[model samples]
Every structure is written in C-alpha cells, then in structure tokens.
Target chain A: MDVTLAREWMRAAAGAIAADADLLTRLDAAIGDGDHGVNLNRGFTAVVAALEKTPPETVADVLIKAGTTLMSRVGGASGPIYGSALRAAGKALPPAAEVQPADLVAALHAGLEAVRKLGGAAPGDKTMVDAYGPAADAFEQAVAGGADLAGAAGAAARAAAAGAEATVPLQARKGRASYLGERSIGHQDPGATSTALIFQALADVS
Target chain B: MKKFINDPADVVAQSLAGLAAAHPELRVDTEEQYIVRADAPRAGKVGLVSGGGSGHEPLHGGFVGPGMLDAAVPGEVFTSPVPDQILAATKAVDGGAGVVHVVKNYTGDVMNFQLAAELAADEGISVETVLVDDDVAVEDSTWTAGRRGTGATLLVEKIAGARAEEGGKLAEVAAIGREVNAASGSFAYALTSGTTPAAGRPGFELPADEIEAGVGIHGEPGRRREKLRPAKELVRSALDAILDAKTFTGPVLLLVNGLGGTPLIELYLIYGEASAYLEERGVAIARQLVGNYVTSLDMAGMSLTLCQATDEMIRLWDAPVRTPGLRWGA
Candidate 1:
C-alpha cells in the first residue's frame, strides 16, 4: 500500500460511514447506546479534514495520522479501540513510502491484536473484534496464497461482512450491549457492522 | 424533543458555556471541554478529577469546586471522554502531589481513563484511579462489562474530594474513594426514557402504566420492565436490590437522586418512603441528599444510593463544599 491508496481508503471509509450512519445508529439503539453511527461519522469526517489540511508522506504516516485524529475526535470506546488499532497497524508497517502485501498482512494482524488488547474482546464476543479478527485472518490467507493487494482486500472485506452478519444471533458478551443480557440477541452488533464498512472501504479503494 | 437547544450538535459546548457564565469560580475550557477549579493544582494537595458523559448534569462538572473535583472532563452526551481530553484534565489538575481519577465503571470511561492515566504517567505525572461500580441493576458477571457506576459516583467524588482537600496523599484519597464505592449501592427505575439531543427522541419507550425497572442513567435497559407501583413499593424494591448485594452495618448516607425530569417534591417523597422503610428495619441514616445531582436528560426517574459510612466518611461529608450543584458548610 502507498500513501495515495491509504488516503483513498480513509476517504472511502468516511463516505461509507456517513452513508450508513442512520442504519448503524438504529442498530446500536437496539442493544447498545445508539451513538455508534454518529460518533464514527464524526470521527471519519475529522480524519478526512486533517488529512486534507496537512498530508502525510508515507502509508504508515497516513494511517497513524488518521488513527490519532479518530482517537482525539471520537469520544467513546470506539475512539481508543479503533484509534489504537490503526496506530498499531501503522507502527507495524515498514517506514518506507510503500509496503508489500505481506507487510500489510502483518500490519492487519497487529491492528487486530491492538483491538483485542484494548477492548479485551475475543472472537464471538459480538464486538468489533468479531469482524476485525476474521478480516485480518482472511487478508493474511489471501496474501499467503499469492493474491495481490486488490484480491486480498476483497477477501478481507467479504470476511468482515460475514463476521458482522454472524453477530445477529449471538448475545453480546462485552461493551454496552452486554448489559442487556439475553435481550441483546437478534440484534446486529453496531461496532462489527461499522468495522465491516471500514474493511469494504479498503477494498473499494484497492 | 422539546428542549431549549438551538443546535443539537452544540449541546455540550453550549451547556459548558452556560456553566462557565454561572460559575466564575470554574475555569471552563470550551475548546478542550473540561472544567477545572480556578485554584486547582494546589502546591501541596493531591488533585481529584472525575468525569463521564455530559447528560448526567451536575455530576463531574457541577461537583468541581473546593471540596470536590479539581478538574472535570465532560464528554459528549452518553459518551466517554476522549483520551486527549482526559490527559489534559489530568495534567491541569496534577499538583506537586499526585492526582486521583474517580472514574465511572462503564467500558468506555474505564478504557479512556486508563489510556489517559498511562499517557500522564509517560509525562511524569503520578495518577491513581478509583473505579465506581456501585449500581446493582446490572449483575456482576463474566458475561457483562460489570455493574455500572451510577449515583454513587457523587458520593465517591464528594468523600474522596474531601480527603484530597484535607491534604491526604494520592493513595489515601483513592483508597477512600474505593471504599465509598465498595460501601455504596444504587438502584433506579425510569418512568420514561431520556432523549439525547442528537437522537431527538427518547432512547427507549415506556408505556403509561409501566416503568423501566433498574434503568441505567443513560436509559440503558435494566433488569426488567414492570407495572408501575406506588412510591412505597418502588422504594422498597430498590432497597431490596441494594441490600441483597451488601449489608450496611453503620449509619448510612442516603441519596435520593433525580434523573433530571423528576421534581423536588417527588424526590422528597421517595426519600421519605425510603427513610421510613430503612427506619423500620432499624438502619440509621446519618446523612442525606436529595435532588437532581446526577441525571439523564429529562428522564423522569430517580435512583437511591446508600453508602455504609464510617466516622471518617461522616466527618469528611460534613466538611465545607462550594460548587455549582452542591454547596453547604462553606
């Protein structure tokens, strides 16, 4: 991935989040606090503005800047969770302007680890981790199978979407929705849905 | 949705502006959205800081004053403060002595405060955190985040803030705060759900004859919804939930807190019922506070908080306090 692609990926994610903002919020209202869509939209908008104002040089710089912006702007668990994930992924990348697909796979693993570390969510906890974990795994597998950036991004995005859908029947085991106990079942996890959108944004840009 | 708000997006900022206008003793940083006592960071005193979502009025922000929080960080409505805001509040309140952060036990608040504490440590500031998880509505289990911090947050801030003001060390202040949290239990029920400015509608719906029992401050679902009962029965149910969790031996500090839409008359009535119920059980009430100290915006409900107070806690509770939402001896 290069700097331009990284910037495009963020722009795509912002557009997707804005487009699905209401849907995400409604989903959250069912089980969580009902602010997930609005919060993520606000954060991504700020990320776009920050990137446009003072552009970063390397792919890693782009991700790091976007992550820092989200951390500062998004005032919720998503801020620290998503923000640290992006920052850790950026840190895991090579310091050069461009990185190989294998390096991107490693960075994806790093981002997933960061999400797990911060939220203490494992797979099937019905959080963003559910989507993020599968997406990272799919991307790594695609890369190992000699898929190019576009092919790997497509695989990861599809995996994330499936992961989000799989949360519908599972009761939340973490975050605000966990407070609902059995009532949280049958609702799509908002955080996981948004994570899917973000991965789709990457695939679209790729 | 009929709030006196010009723009939903600006509720937090506008409210902070109003708070600053009303209380000149507070230094409200509109840009960073934090409130600090004008005389914060006293030369030899440990600073006390606490904060959460902005919808809970007079909570962390209103309680910022001489005998309360030295700094308060208010996030978006029902949202946790970002790490940057928390880090700034910590730095602003850090005296030569350490700082104590009294954090509510929500997932977002806990994670954000922990991140800020780590950042503050990297900057050479010593910080201690006291997590308040006193709400008994949500069961404490591995399947959930844990019991949420609710009305007892006010107790922790007041008691711990008093300790900090009395020149206690950071550890002492945090320990006192933790003790208060451990000794306290809260239960709430909502007649109606609160509307967030951005949502422009009630978070949840309640029928005319029904109530959301054990509702959270942010209108999160509670234990169950049940038919509305008389004030006495409601109070008894709340007490039963609390007493089931922990038994209070000594005189208790009782707080009948409204959820913004509740009036003083209703709160006093609930308090009276609670006082009578506890009196029947021979539980002594040493101190009591009533009103909308911590609230969800326009949610017509109330919560009862009982703190098993020690002699030192009672002494500190009677100490001077001057702030926007609460003031007495001073």
Candidate 2:
C-alpha cells in the first residue's frame, strides 16, 4: 500500500471505532471494566488529528506515528497493545514510500507478533490475538495465492470477523475478562471485535 | 454517578488539580499526570515509584511523600498509566541510586509498567519492578491472570517506601516489596459496584439483600454473589479466605480498608468484628490501620489485608510517613 492508502486505512479505522464505540463498550461491560470502546475511540481520534497535523512521508511512518499517538493518548491496555502492533508492523515494512502486497502481509505478521508478545495471549485466549492472528494468516495466504491488495485485505477482514465471532463461546483466559472465568463465556470479546473493525477498515480503504 | 464533579471526562484532571492545590509537598504534573515528592531524586537514595489507575486514590498518589513513594503516575480512571508517563515518573525519581517500581499485578498495569521499565533501561536508568498479587479472591493459577493485587499493595508500598527512605539499595527495596506482597493476602466484598466517571453508572448491580463476594477494586465481578450476611459473618468469611490462603504464625499488621464510599464508622465496625475473629483464631494484631488507604471510586465495600509481620517489617511499618492519605510520626 502507498502512504495515501495507509492514511485512508487509519481514517477508516477511526471512523469505524467511533461508530461502534458503544457496541464495544457493551461487549466489554459483560466481562471487562467496560472502557474498551471509549478508550479506542479516544486513541484513534487523536491518531486522526496527529496525522492531519503532520502527515508522514512513507506508509511505514504513517503507521508508526499513529501507533505512537495511540500509545500516548489511549490510557489503557488497548493503547499499548494496538500501538505496539502498528509500530512493529511499520518497522517491519520496507522504508520505501510504497510496498507490495507481500510486504504488507509480512508487516501484518509482525503486527500480530507484537500483540502476542505484549499481551502474552495465545490465539484461543479470547483476546485481540484471536482476531489478529487469523487476520494476519489469512492476509499472508491470500498474498501467497497471488491476490491483489484489495482481495487480500477482504480475506483478512472476513477472517477477523469470523475469529471475533468465535470468541463468544470460549472462556477468557487473559485480561480483565479472565476474572469472570466461566461467566466470561457467551460474550464476544471486545478486543477481538475491535480488531475485526480495524481489519475491516483496511479492506474498506483497499 | 452523583459524584461532585464538573464533568465525567475531567474528573481525574480536576481532582489532581485539587490535590496539587492542597498538598504543597507534592509536585503534581497535570499534563504528564504524575505526582512526585517536592524534593525528589534524593541523591544516593533509592527512588521508589508506584502507580495504577486514578480511581484508587491515596494509593500511589496519596502515599507519595517522605518515607513512601518518591513518585506516583496516575492514568485515566480505572486504567493503567501509559508507558511514556510511567517512564517520565521513573526518570524523574531516579536518584544516583536506582529506582524501584511497585506495580499492581493487573494485566494492563503490569504490561504498561514493564514497557516503561524497558524504556527507562534504554535511557540508561537502572530500574527494578516488584509485582503485587495478593488478593485471595481470584484463583492463582495458569488459567487466569492470577490473583489481583488489592489491599496488600498499600502494605508493599509503605514497607518498601520505608526501606528506600532508609537508604536501602534498589534491589533491597524491591525485595522488601516482594516479601510484603508474598506475606500478605486480601479479600473484599462489595455492597455496591463503583461508578466510573466515564460510565456514570454502577459497573454492576447487586440485589438489595445480596453482595458481590471477592469483588475487585475495579468493580470486576468476583467469585460469586451471595445474600448479604451480618457484619460478623461477612468479616469471618473474608478473614477465612485470607487466613486460608497463607499462614501467619506471629503478630500481623491488619489493614481494614474502606472502599471509597464506605464510612469510617462502618469500617471501624468491620475492624472490630475482624479483630475479634482474629483474636478468637489466636492471631495477634500487632499494628493496625483502619481507613480508606486504597479504594475503588464510590464503591461501597471493604477489603481486609493482613501482613505476616516480621521485626524488620514492623519497624519499617512504624517509621515516619508524611503524605496526604497517610501521616504519622512525621
């Protein structure tokens, strides 16, 4: 993706987060402290403002800048987790202004790895990793199959949505939701849901 | 929901402004959202820092002063401080000696503090972290995040702070904090859920005759919900949970802490019941603190923390501490 496409992806993600903030909050209320939606909304809004104030030169720089802004402003677990993911992804990308679909796939894998490292959450742990891991894998597979950016992004978005939905029946084993044990079941994980929204934003922009 | 606040979003900032206005000994950075001792970075002395969500007031912030934490980083209400803020606090409090971070064991708090410590290390500041996970309510196993750090956090901060003030090195301070956390256990029951400023409603609802046992400081649901019992019975249950988790042979330090909305009168009543039960169980209460030292905002509940006190710990506990939330023998 180019820098312009990267900026559009971030803008779309912010818009999606703002629109679905209440839904995310309600999902979190079931098992967590109920601030995921609001926290993400605040962070992404700042990301939009920051990008507008000083637009980055490369796609990697745009992602890194957005990540740093979220890290500073989000004030919760999501900020650091999502921010670290984006930063790691940006760092993984080529320094060139534009990147191939395969490069984006590798960057997505790096982002997913960052999330797993920061949270210590496995795929089945009912965290953002659940959605992110599947999305990254799907994107990589799509790119390997000679798919274009739009086709690969669409595949990743669909995988993320399915992965998020899969969290509804599983018990949480990490984060605040883990405090509920069995009660954490039967509710969609807010982090996974938000991750799905972010991946969908990528697809939308692509 | 009915809190005395100008706006829900501004609650943390406004309260910090008020704290800065009231406590001249504290240097509150409203923008950075950290509070430090006025004369921080005491050369040749280990710097002690502790922090978490803003709702738990008097915790890291109120305990920042002489013989306590050198700095406290506050995040948004019921949220962990960002890494940049934590790194700033760590750097600000780093005397020539190293700095010790006393972190509560929530996933968010631990991750943020760990990130900050790495940042500090990159900047050439020596840093150590002691995690507090003493609550007996959550099951301590691989399946979960482990028992949450609750009332015992106050004990860790106080005893560790005392050691740091006495010129103990960073390792020693962190070791002492870890020891306090290991030797302590806590249990809490909530009469009502806390209302975060952003939410503007109780996090959860409890039937009038029921209570949330093993409730977390952030209003996270506990082990189970049961019908409310008499003060004596409730205290007995809480004590049973803690005492069962760990063995305390010698005299202990008892902290009967009120969760923000609780009154002193009710807390004292809980204390009376707790002490009598402990006395019956032949557990001596050598030192005691009864007040809202650590709290969940507007949560009507109480948590009991008991530290198996050794001579050194007792001596440190008795040391002079001058701060807004706690002041004695200054």
Tens digits of lDDT, candidate 2, A10-118: 9999999999998998788778877888889989999999999999989999999999998888867888899999999999999878999989988998988888887
Residues B127-208, model 2: lDDT tens digits: 9999999989888987668889999999998899999999898899999999999999999999998888777667888889
The TM-scores that each candidate's chain B achieves against the reference are 0.99, 0.99
Candidate with best DockQ? 1
| TM-score (C-alpha, index-matched) for candidate 1 | 0.98
TM-score of 2: 0.98
Over B255-328, each residue of candidate 1 has an lDDT whose tens digit, in order, gives 99999999999999999999999998788999999999889889999999999999999999999999988999
lDDT of each: 0.91, 0.91
lDDT of 1 at B241: 92
**Chain A TM-score, each candidate:** 0.99, 0.99
